[model samples]
Target: MEKDRRSLILDCAKELFATRGYHSTGISDIIEKAQVARGTFYLYFDSKRAVFDVLLESAFETILSSVKPVIVGPTPDRNNILKQLRINLGRALAPLFADRHLARIVVSQAETLDEVAAARMEAFYAALRHYLEESLQEGQEKHVIRQLNTKIVATAAVGMIKGIVWTHATGSESFDYHEVVEEIVEWAAMGIVTR
Candidate 1:
């Protein structure tokens, strides 16, 4: 079936990209791995960049979808938001962090690619930014915590999470990720003040 073949190409491409790096991985490599002709790949995607877009966007979508309902649902409780973020983060970071080679260059490559990659990355990440902004707005409106700039806080929180992911993916530290995450949530929810 057409759908099955497309999926096959995508899966093969993901593996190749993650392992071989984007620039080093050629179109022929993907076709060879998929056992499909070069023309078949073109039918589904214009270039290697297209496959990268699909992979990155799908990863982002999975994380956003997993967390969207929990953030926007009836409960805007501060504790609930933290809990929901924690739950969804595992789903998002686990696979990506598990791959060292993939994580190293994945985020940075967007800026270096052609116009298509730049636009695709912008759209994907802009939506992510919007989601963060929305969740923070809801939390602030409910007086869940001290009033702060919601957009700034949301973007900062996302930045912190990325830092954690980068550290973990690079094997830079031996600290437990869950503990670091808890510390991150605590810091985000409440300023450090000795009780």
Candidate 2:
């Protein structure tokens, strides 16, 4: 019951945030939408930022889980895998783009907030970088990618992907998201393929 109520509160808050923006979505709005007492909210989260933190955490976890299988399981050559990579990546990252409130909150507070949000963002980015580095390292060992600095490349790749995500989310559809992702995958693997 407790877990369900907490999840319900989260779901309600996410909806409110998506619809009304984070700054405007008060605890009262959240509780009303959740159909739970105001006091119940305090049991789960201390502040609005805390709720945002939970949402961000879930988004990261979803993205990580979505990408993990494609990276960890045995896969084919880079050329053959680009499509799968793009698809998996699109699905993984598309959520962060789709959830306007979560995306806006994380991106906006990334540099503006004091210790808590800063630390949370830093940890999440570090974990993402670490995952990308490991994936690149394995691809390097398999001769599926270039012998470049995996850390830099991975970080840059993630940054590029995030940029693309932001662009697609905020800008008009100048190009398809799949096209953008495939382009990134292609460029990333081009110089690495051996004869």
Candidate 3:
């Protein structure tokens, strides 16, 4: 089927990109790995960048879908906000845990590809920041959190999470995602300063 072939190409491309890095991987490489003809690859994607773009978009979609359920409905109160945050963190990390390749692409490699790719990465962060900002605003309204600059707070939170995820994905190894999530949520909700 056409869809299956396209997916096959994408799967092969993702594996190549993850293993070989985007710049090192070429169109021919993708086709060969996919076991598809050159013309078949052209039919599905115009170029390597095109395939990378699609992969990045798909990863973002997965992240958005993962986080949507936790934050979309009723606002959480003080008692439940921490629990909600934990759920949100767990869901956010699920895709990355499942696919380190996708995580590497989104977190580190995309921006290095080109200006358009960099902008796409920026937009991805913006989307995450927007979601965090909305949640923080809702928390403020509910008097669950202190009055703060939601934009700055959201940006910082997203940056922290991304930094940890990137390090875990690309660094030496032995990083536990649940521990990262737990520490991040604890710090985000309760500051380091002791009372």
Candidate with top lDDT is: 3
Error of 3 at 127 (Å): 1.6
Error of 3 at 88 (Å): 1.8
* lDDT of predicted model 1: 0.68
List, residue by residue over 1-195, the lDDT tens digit for candidate 3: 999999999988888888789999999999899899999999988989899989999888888877853342364444456667788788888888777878888887887888989998899889899987887776666566678888998888888888877876685564687887789878966752111
Point out where model 2 deviates above 4 Å.
Answer: 1-8, 15-25, 32-36, 43-46, 69-76, 168-175, 191-195
Task: Provide TM-scores for the models.
Answer: 0.73, 0.74, 0.87
lDDT of all the models against the reference?
0.68, 0.71, 0.80
* Residues 36-143, model 2: lDDT tens digits: 887899999999879877887887788777775344336555556565667777777677666655565556544345676678777777888898788778777776
Residue 115 in model 2: shift from native, Å? 1.7
**What value of lDDT does candidate 2 attain over all alpha carbons?**
0.71
Off by over 4 Å in 1: 1-4, 39-43, 69-78, 98-106, 169-180, 192-195
* Most TM-score-accurate candidate: 3
Per-residue lDDT for 104 in model 2?
A: 53
